[model samples]
Target: MNIPKWILDVFYSYLTSELIYFDGEYPIATPVATFFNPTKNSIILSTSVSFYNKVKCIKQNPNVSILYSKHEYSGLSEKPVVLVHGSAKVHEKDFEKNNAYLSKLIEEQKETWKKEVYIKMGRELDSFIGRRLMDWYMLRILIEIIPDGIVCWKKEANILGSVDDLSKTIGSVKGDAVFAFMGEKYPIGIPVKLRKSNRKFLIENPTLNLKEGQKACLLIHSHNKYVKEITLTRYKGRISRISKTSRISRISTREGEIGEIEFIPTSKFSFKQGGILNSIRFILDGKRRAKKFLERYKKT
Candidate 1:
């Protein structure tokens, strides 16, 4: 893996990255704190055993992609967004060994992460109360991703149809979005134009060969420079191609077909919504969920 210096810098310092993997068929995307293991030259991420769905997905299909596209307050200049196509290995059997490595990896980022969490929710993650409440998160599993290839670009090419001037769009969502579609070897994610159509969403010029009735995912999220305020929403939906004839009159007439993929969301999940009360509620709810997951883990 001959990754460039700039890309490694981003991977080493990035606060969070979006992890996309195949869940049997459709892509599932989630945000995760990433770490670089120089010894093994692998990307490392730890999650609670409670997140069985993600672990199960990796076991079912190891092909995955990690995208580092956000650059708000990381003390770094604007850099090309890096997308890593990789194969994943989940470390689950040896609880003690995995936990020790996770503990050290976590300690390295504890100050930075704790500072951000403190600013966002006025809570200390290492505090006594926090420790007691988040024990489930401490019962961890490690995900090691070995990169097969890397793609870096500042932004998506503006070859797709333009929706900048369209007055009436479809969905009611406004945030940075990462579009996921099946690639030759694995699911790939890229920054794309997101707009509304009817009650669903539309992505402009999906570049990849897509068909009608195919399943995909849209990750919509927003965050302030301070990192105190954030909101993320994930949509799992099926694709329907909007042909050239159905293209709106305002759409540009270029060489390629004026193509668009309509995303009809069949399910939705809001992982984070920033606010003092909301954060408190989320923490409390997480504690309960963690307890249940721990019980579930022990049983298995």
Candidate 2:
């Protein structure tokens, strides 16, 4: 495949740059070791770190923007630059699938180079370790960078002369603006409510401090849009039914009174200053209480 020279240059420059930032936040950037052609129009660039955290950020807030430019190189007219802005998500399965294709590409390159070495050596040596080495080498993982949008600037002028000029020279010259063929520039959030369509269960108490393995009844308040009634229970199992149609009728512990509890999906809830273990405890306890209540009703 023919790779654009401008893209190659930009990738090279970015590799040596100090850092990439977003809204004063420093995002981790690693080298794109191998590129995988997953589909006819898509390519995945491998990175050093797992993008799970980044995907979480995008899911939580989709509004994201990025700018790339060379500050040190000012002599070149029409400085090479690009900006990209788009939403991102983590797809574990897709990433793994694409990485497999990239492995094949890496092997092809290695084999081509090995042939040249074999020709120079004039003979093949013992091949005992060949299979094992190849297996170990191909086990490396790769990250996939799926580009949403891109902007680019050309460096040189075309046959159109001044009209096609990208630089400051004898390029495309329009009426008021002297159009020099300038190098190509490739430039390139929101919270969504978790509803039943995305996932079931309403999280009413998002800020309560619950210990790991503790029991609590998740009371769903139907009247209030945001307020969910959570009841702390001492039992541990499954919630068959949760209602927010009326005020919560059960009270459990000092955390708060259980007014009708609403259920929210765990994926939609964000922890302000606590771990997920506590959240899981709250959910499990609520489920357990609901199961016990159902059992008592059946017995009665």
Candidate 3:
């Protein structure tokens, strides 16, 4: 197996440096370098001649551990370390490859140091020292963790009162689900439907297809003891008032007989009404009319 040249260089440089570890309770040092083998998917250690006896003792026991120190700027309380409770064996091929990588890595380090010296020379004396004194080295590690499932905070509220599922409906109306303090006598069971005339006039037009499973207020008009719903849909814009003027003539009829009913929009029932119920009813009607307009547009 072959590893990238750049990665091999990094591995070699890290290996040659003395690795500090904890032996029992006291800190111990190991003057060994590591080399990686692609086939084994592990790193191999090369012990120095001076530490050869110490390495032999640890190899015999085969229950040693390795600890890596954290950079001062790591901002972590625990030092990065790994433990090994297994035996070790010498691999000649791995050792040879490690040695070659380490030699090249050391050369690269020398080049980097030379460049640093040039950079420092270009800066002010005080600035150069400040840069070297700064203690901030960032270290990042990547790990993957997958969640099993989600746990909702309010199970009952989510199933019954959650507005997430009705986002489309609320968004279509340009409104969000919110709780309002309506009077105790607020009618909650009334079934309101969208109407077509609502959209012809430039009112808040919510589409009928996006009906929300919630109660809305409506304006109920009573005339001649008969309910005739006149929402933002039925008489939109100034058209209703304008239509009233187009009458040919008004003829008087006998008493107790209906002559003619003049239809006109007054300020009392117009969209400008400052009542929450009226506004809700107007919006609902506009939504219905808007839906009809869309359907007609689709057919044409």
Model 2 / residue 228 / CA error / Å: 52
- Tell me the spans in candidate 3 whose CA falls farther than 4 Å from its real position: 1-31, 72-81, 91-300
TM-score of each: 0.79, 0.27, 0.23
Worst-scoring 10-residue span by lDDT in model 1? 158-167
- lDDT at 115 for candidate 3? 28
Better of 2 and 3 by TM-score: 2
Better of 1 and 3 by lDDT: 1
Residue 267 Cα positional deviation in candidate 2, in Å, after optimal superposition: 28
Which digits, one per residue and each the tens of the lDDT, describe model 1 over residues 1-300? 666666777876567789999987788888777778766778988777657789989988998889887755555675567777789999987766986785565555434443354234324544687677665556678899988766665443211122121112222211268877676668877666667777788776533456788888998877655444668898888887655432433465344444566889988888666777887786677677767877876898
- Which digits, one per residue and each the tens of the lDDT, describe model 3 over residues 168-255? 2221111111111111211111112222243321113211221222222222221111111322211211122112121222433333
Q: RMSD, model 2, all Cα superposed?
A: 23.4
Question: Against the true structure, whose lDDT is highest?
Answer: 1
Off by over 4 Å in 1: 94-99, 106-123, 155-175, 224-228, 243-254, 257-259, 274-277
